[model samples]
Target chain A: MTTTRIHSTRTPAFVEFQASPGHRRPVAAPSNVDVAVIGHSGQVGSALLARLDRTTEAPELPGLQLREGINRSRHLLVGDGSVNQQDRNPGTLSGLGARLLAGGRPAVIVDCTADATLPRHYPEWLRAGIGVVTPNKHGFSGDPELYRSIMQAARKGRAPLNYSATVGAGLPVIDTLKRLRRAGVKPAAITAAVSGTLSHVFTRLSAGQPLSEAVADARHRGFTEPDPLEDLSGRDVARKLVIMLREAGLSQVRVELEPVVPDAWAAALPGQVDTIEALREKDAGWREKIVEAQRDERVWTYLARFDGRTARVGPVEVSRDSAFAGLAGSGNRISIESAEGEAIDIHGPGAGVDVTATAVLADLVDAAFLLTRKG
Target chain B: MTTTRIHSTRTPAFVEFQASPGHRRPVAAPSNVDVAVIGHSGQVGSALLARLDRTTEAPELPGLQLREGINRSRHLLVGDGSVNQQDRNPGTLSGLGARLLAGGRPAVIVDCTADATLPRHYPEWLRAGIGVVTPNKHGFSGDPELYRSIMQAARKGRAPLNYSATVGAGLPVIDTLKRLRRAGVKPAAITAAVSGTLSHVFTRLSAGQPLSEAVADARHRGFTEPDPLEDLSGRDVARKLVIMLREAGLSQVRVELEPVVPDAWAAALPGQVDTIEALREKDAGWREKIVEAQRDERVWTYLARFDGRTARVGPVEVSRDSAFAGLAGSGNRISIESAEGEAIDIHGPGAGVDVTATAVLADLVDAAFLLTRKG
Candidate 1:
């Protein structure tokens, strides 16, 4: 019954209602939708809007209230604008505000904010029968009990809760895993390179580039976080691994990430090390190390191994012929090995504004389909 | 609905039910099982019996019969005893024939028979609500329409139709494909080395052994079919490929296997040429050919490719570093490329009496669970 509320700077943002007696409301007839994009500045939020706009065959619904820092909209409008600019709109939702029941109408909340600290309001959303589509992995991976609670709420609410974008970007990993579970095949182990940023960095390092150059290359290619060092540090990959593990039913497992943060960055000023040249100066020795590994027939790989009961995260030296060694670019690959069957290896693009957005869009489509079925 | 009935034996073995004029006898509740074992004399059949015996945890309903060939049996029991073995107690429905449904009890017809001709009875068994479990790939793969008919009957009658052993032995290829489909994934392509016998033969050939020696070694290791030519001819792999394709929703495709039977066996008497010696004779000349291919850093692989609309079967030379080239032993491997996501690879054991029987048992357990759920 714990309800978490996230605030926007534009208008009063309401806390999701728990499934309690006073919160019960009559089901409303299906009608056009009015949606609010929470964390519109984030990747997933933008994607959801694009997907809704492209659906020409669908019945025209009331459009979204473009809110950035606050919620103040009295009416919905059809248009696109930057989140920062929309923050100045007079009708944006800002702090704790009035609860509006999405009812039986096509009202949706697309949470695309990457802020890990934001309180996940899955229960509240589910109780109100409002569909939720998110690219955020945190909700499911954070606490096992809460994850199950969210699923239970969705079932009770008869609403869709989709998080496909939380796993393999557009690779369909979550859907695939769900299918396997439904078919009674238990996953025995999961080995993955779930971060495009990490994979690209590894690919560059394996090619004998220093860690700094790899980070710069990833940034130039738009494959890494704005601060490239954040990816090299392994937090991004760790979060993805946690999400995958939770989906596989290992809810309580904690992934211990061995931070291989470049040593040079430790001695530099935080702001100074944010740039590519500063990062390069810190880990220049990685070039020789990578060359040595190549001479010995080993390739550098960022790996996440999830054996049913536990999970581990680290960088390993793999043979060139191994599956992990062959993964290239900003691709993400996941291999699920089962006790009774052959391993299933799924590979594809893992990170990008477009790819991540596409994944979120896919989740939205799934939710929309579920809602249609419910009706 | 147009229904195709495929029968293995030329003589149709059927039991007719007399319909009361203008009256339907209250459909008798199934109280006993009159089963038919199509390939009772084969290894797969023997292993299936072993699996049935282990299912003692759940007592099997009585009135069970096992029939092979054209003979009718009131009670068909296969064991190492006298052919006329009978139980001292005459149970209800004891005199029933091979018609699985007339036994007045839940019936299970296990077709461990590998005879391609026997697939005709699949629809008949399905219509009668008699669950059919088979290691034979022929029924589902023979005609695409038959696959649809079988699935429809299974759903309509709420009967189980499983043939996991048909493609990957104990590996869960069929099950995985079913799960993938249920999750809304449209498979675009399937690439696999599905024949264990062929994989072993090729592996030995790659190791510089004579063709005859490789065949002999395969037979000695129980890797090849009794008739080594069956494996060499590529029919086994073709059947497996067809089954996989059918499972992925291509119910109309039929594979016309190209005969790759070794030319040396064309004129030789069946028992005259020992495999090892035959391979030795063929090896002397083929050695240079294999050596030349290896010199170019190529490895030979027998591959089956299915691209939704069309399927091709052939052996091709691939780079040693390719995924298929690294496959070892008699492993069965399948790669699925789908429109909804990237490619997925599944690989493991393809054939063995124990493994094949295990697959059948797994299907049985699945059916039991489903039946329990329905109840």
Candidate 2:
């Protein structure tokens, strides 16, 4: 009988296996992924699934099959005659099971869940060589160390991990940064108006609308978070900036976030009034504040900067004709300034299911190519 | 005695070597080059040579000793002791013997020349595993097949070729593009207000100066080409756009140059007058044409685009607040519309010997790294 003792170190499980005797492993098998949706029930998730279902197969990957677990009870299996959808949770495959099926097996995982904790699974899935497409910003921006770890795992495992949907929904800020880096240009700074919800509210306020009315209008347009305050408080912009900063190689830098909470929110119990009602109660005062800004010819913009240190800033007033000015609707604008030279600006829609889904799909295609090439 | 037969094909010479018994020969001794400038003697060349001479050890290869033929001459050697005041015939290796001796060995080449034909020597040098750094735009922008051939030769020969000075004199556009590509985002389009000379003229014209006066002012400031028409005609910007396009994989396509030549020079003899004098000689109608553009509140900009197809435009009117608007002095502005659905805009100093030389040095560092890594 052989007894194998494992040492506890920070190294990966596979690396630790070096001490085991005579464990020859087979080369990873090539995989052909047909479909992958990370957040099965969310807005972006459903949109991606529908798009995949509608796409006609091409020669890039032959005999592609959407591998839903037999335990997925709610997913309706389409195109191919296979196992019953009512029998299992198609999107809930265990790490080992995902690896077994997606390892050397072509597969994609499209993550739409906003749950910050979901990204912890990225490294495991990537190590098993599964392509990950996500709209979750938390994985890439929440912590720089972990973000790099995930990237390293993807590289070591020869998998693709794409997250274009993380910032600016459908806009390609991440991709733009990657290209700039590839071309050998380092960004000096990034000035981005990245929150669709925030942009909408700011626009309404600039036009003399009360902050509460603007918040309500943003909600009607599906631009605001459920609590409304999430957008108004500047956290959304801060999160997006952090993601950009990480890509810019500034990791773990503290991001200073100043609450842009309405005046009434300061007086009300944090949990008692939803952000929408608080802003509504302070409508008169907020209107006056906005009017005063306009009288001074200033444009209100939520700006962030990653200036070689921590990402910093909050809602600030910029002069007209400045890059940050004139943004409307749910637009996202990003300007990157690097040690190399002047800033590079990127702007487009920051939210929208279709655009976000398209971005995710683009990432999936990129991942598919990466995996296939590695094989 | 063995009979030897050498056969040639359309492919590069080094690629055709045979290892068969009768044809096999031992590889030659590797050549140590401290620098390998692609286009070695033009405006940028003179400054580059001066910079290298002042900074590096005469001409010593990184670690190799100076061999007799290799270091016999210092002044005549490429990138040796100093920029020679006298001009030699284009093809001859003039004071190479003295130059080679002054410098321990030629470790690097500062390519200030912009000739397309210069790249023909790259494959041979690369096969010899020499390192090359250049500001020449042609090597990266010319024919795609040729560019690929050069890249393949460099890869197989384990050589390093760097050309950061190809796109934005010293702005780091190429470096940025490379990073973006590496990060998994492909550029969709590239737009730029990219000429110091053109920008100066445009600004002058916008300020109500006559076209002729603007051209003269540009010349006085050393921003115009020796034949200012080249700058005025938008050919320079076209070349830059071609470089960016090729980097983005549109290598096979030729950039269609839409001549934006001033009306006064449209039918003039090539050598009839300096661009400034030629514009001055224009009929009163030309001045009227200039005033008309300004009346409409438009600014003239030399613009180039790679919208899936290579195209160049400008010295035409573009409205204020557009991407090309508001470029000051000799600054360069480049807007890259990436496949990731966003546009990246970069602006900075477009011309200066020191800046361009710095860019060339950056490329040299990059080449050094590539060579070391391959080794």
Per-model chain A TM: 0.76, 0.80
C-alpha local distance difference test of each model = 0.57, 0.56
Question: Model 1 chain B, poorest ten-residue lDDT window?
Answer: B16-25
Write candidate 1's Cα lDDT for A41-109 as tens digits. Answer: 445555555555543222211223332222222223333453233333443432212233513345556
Tens digit per residue, CA lDDT, model 2, A1-375: 001111111211110000011101112333456555545657776766565532232222222355542222344344447544553443444543354463346666766778787788788877766777788877776655566567766654556678877887655577556534323445666677787777777777887778878889989987777777666667667777767765543443567665566334454557666666766766876566666667776666566655554456466666654657667775677666546454444455667776677667656665664555333
Worst 10 residues of 2 chain B by lDDT: B15-24
Q: For residues B170-216, what per-residue lDDT tens digits would candidate 2 score against the true structure? A: 66567556534323345666667778777777677667777778788
Q: Write the per-residue lDDT of candidate 1 for residues B266-369, one digit (tens) a residue.
A: 44646666545555655665556557668977656566766666565555555655666645555777777756445555555666675676667656554443
Interface RMSD of 1: 26.4
Scanning candidate 1 chain A in windows of ten residues, the lowest lDDT window is A16-25
Model 2 residue B303 lDDT score: 63
Model 1, A228: alpha-carbon shift in Å? Answer: 3.4
Among these predictions, the greatest TM-score belongs to 2
